[model samples]
Target: MLALAALPLGVRVTVLEPDEHAPARLCARHLHAPYTDPAALNELAACDAVTLEFENVPVEALAALQDRVPVRPGGALLARSKHRAHEKRALQGAGATTAPFEAIEADTDLPGALARVGGRGILKTSELGYDGKGQARVNSDAELRAAWENLGRVPCVLEGLVSFEREVSLAVARTPAGQVAFGPLVENVHRDGILRSSVFPAQVPDGTEARARELARAVADAWALEGLITLEFFQLPGGDLIVNEVAPRVHNSGHLTQDGGGVSQFEAQVRAVLNLPLSDWRPLHPTAMVNVVGVDGPDGSPLTPDWAAIDALDGTRVHLYHKAHRHGRKVGHVNLVAPDPGTLRARLASLEPLIP
Candidate 1:
């Protein structure tokens, strides 16, 4: 998607992926090779500059590429964000608030760690966890032990449960020259640990928006980010915002910017990476973005979408990923833009039946 946006700006994008059927292949020129493949890395290194769409790209691969081509957000940011303990320490070092957390290594006393986190907490793998995977919520010692064992008893972080009022995300872009741009704070709702919807210009408390923007800028600056970064935050009932997680690339929560913000997150990313000027992050209209999850059919395959119903909606744009789907997998998204929030909400409600 970002590649498509970059094309009009005279930026050519070449994607490198191991899966030939990867959805991004539909939109950009693709190299069908493993990310760690030396041949593929050489091809990528030949590019003017390189930026990653997903954060899970191996640090070793990136380090090899960095010697030849510039990797935005850099290896240090990737190394820190990929590990829960490092992420927490980075956020704390930046003076950003985060949930109470304790690291659990192999030799750590599991019961004592659980007790320290109030006995009811989420134990997450230190690395490679997303979309609700690699985490276990436990309320008892037995469950904690089971969770730890289930995770192969690897390194983990135990986070105390938080009573947050709502979840929101802020997407910010920065260039190597210190230029910065911030997208609107988006209020998001998650179902089964997957994001269901993201509404822009979140209806936050009076000072919350300002605070989120400040914190996002601080994070971007802290990392000396050269591309886009997203910060997921938990807004507590008392109007305090705590950093939940960080994604060092274009984020799902900022998908609405594709339609509502003249300069979509993709374009902003391209601009930042190419050293082009960025536009102000202002929405042209109120928008609601709903993720289209895959539904299982009788034979256990993903059911075909209701294209007839989806095509009939006005002011709604549908983006479908050209990939096979599984239950709860993000196949695509629908963007509904309107003159105001009320109308956007109504449109979103009417389109609910077509979501899955």
Candidate 2:
């Protein structure tokens, strides 16, 4: 829905979705977030233009779309993101700092992996993994063996976990003509490895923010990418930032931009793909975005949010994704903006009752 909302008014968008229905846009429905979808051939035939919402579409699907209309970022970048090892390798080649890691394949030696990353590391699947799924944290030999068994012994990557102070991210977009624009740095909070909240102007030092933005811009240039790209970073205790990962699509951390930033991530992504000039990247207000997960809501029924109360606050905004309710499902989000981070935090807390 966000991807659709960002489209230029004059540009006609034919959404290539596996869902044969209108209400259910499969483009934004993948759990693992694969950039390619095998059903692309059929979806592309239904329209004159084509675009994608998620990065997890199957490569074969994008190939089909390429035969019809031009696909931004192309299949190569999408394929690179599916495999954790490849994504890390690409970032390294771009001269970006990342955590030490090793690839785990069917015949790959476990002792060789141990030598590269040490005993404690996180095992992530090669393809189709997100929000803590298809991943496991292994600190011992028994855990590693169990994780491999639990994951069906599929190919994976082992990334050594670091003792970082906090998680931060930057969202940037690049035009087909090579122009680029960036959104404000956002601080992310995760619960059980799932994103719970995000705040703009991430309470980091000015120098740190500058470095984050620089890294993001460099990534966009590295890909020669012409769409939204989100780069996750880890702020170390010593005030240095290291790139964690990249997502070649609209990111959860940038959801606050809809009402807080001068140019929303959605709009930026749209303009880039449409070959339009980039908009000014300014902050409308200091904002904090809270994710509303369906964990503690009513069962077997839609949870109706208290909109009247939410609409009363100044600069308070809400966005509800039209998705069916399920455990841990992201149904909607609330963005609260104020003069400072503290005030924004307080305002966000006041809207909790209105969330469900």
Candidate 3:
């Protein structure tokens, strides 16, 4: 998607991905090599600017290219985000309210950590955890110990679960000069810790939405960010919003902008990284996005989606990643737009069975 967005701007992209069959290979210049390969890093250094789409990028790799090209969002932010403990601390440091949590780095810390977080919480790896991976739920000492052992006993953060009405996310784009663009707050639904769908405009109070943007911008400003940063929030019944996690790049929740008939998040990333003028972040329609996760059904049967059937539905557009579908893999997404919320909800319900 980034490659498609950059093409009109005449910005060529060279992708360094270890997966030879990566869908990006179809559009961008494919450098089929490991991310840290010295040769690949040198090749990337020749580009006008470098931006990361995922958080697990090796910070040292970005450091290697710093002297030769611009790395948007910078290596500093990446380092902080790579570790969950550091991320939570940074959020609180910026005066954002996040879930109550404690960091655990050893066996003895488990008991105290559990007690600190109300004796029950999620144990997540401090690093390399996403899409419901590298974490476990625990309610007692035995469960915590077993989960920790199951997780390989790595550096982890125990987050105390809190009650909230719904989940929402806000995307913020920042330039090197400190200018910012904020995307509308979008309500999100997650199944098994992976994003299932998202709806635009959030159905949130104007002030609550404004507060979300304020928190996102504050973190971006504090981090001296350059590029897109998305902050996920849990909206409480009392209308308070607490930070859940932060992604220092364009996020899955903001994918609706791709078909929203305005400046998409991909373009925003390009503009922010290149120090170009940003565009308006408003969308033309009320949009909802449902991820096309793998092609498997609940009974473990292959159920590849019929494009014709999908096309038969109104207000729907398909975006395929052109990758092999494995269980729980996000191969692509479908965007649905409606004249109003009532129609959108009905469309989503009808389209649910079509997704696998």
Best by TM-score: 3
* Clashing residue pairs found in predicted model 1: none
Encode model 1's per-residue lDDT on 1-356: one tens digit a residue. Answer: 98889889988889999898977777788999988999989998999889978888899989998778878878889898889999988998888999888898775467587778776899999999899999999888788888989999899998989999999998888887888888888999998888999997688889998899899888888878888888999999978999999998989988888888588888888888887888557578998898988889888877766778877987789887776777878889988888888888888888877866
Local distance difference test, candidate 1 = 0.86
lDDT values, one for every candidate: 0.86, 0.75, 0.88
- Clashing residue pairs in candidate 3 are none
* Steric collisions counted per model: 0, 12, 0
Q: Per-residue error at 216 for model 2, in Å? A: 1.7
List TM-scores for all candidates, in order: 0.96, 0.87, 0.97
Report how far off residue 169 is in candidate 3 (Å). 0.5
lDDT of 3 by residue, 1-356 (tens): 88888989989898988998989888999999888899999999988889988888888888888778989988989999889999999999998998889888898787677778887899999999999999998988788889889999899999998899999998899988878988878999999878999998678765898788789889998888989888999999867999999998889998998886788888888898998998548567888899988757678786787678878899999999998868888999999888888888898888877886
For model 3, the local distance difference test gives 0.88
Model 2 misplaced regions, further than 4 Å: 20-49, 280-282, 296-314, 352-356
How many clashes (backbone atoms < 3 Å, residues ≥3 apart in a chain or on different chains) does model 2 have?
A: 12
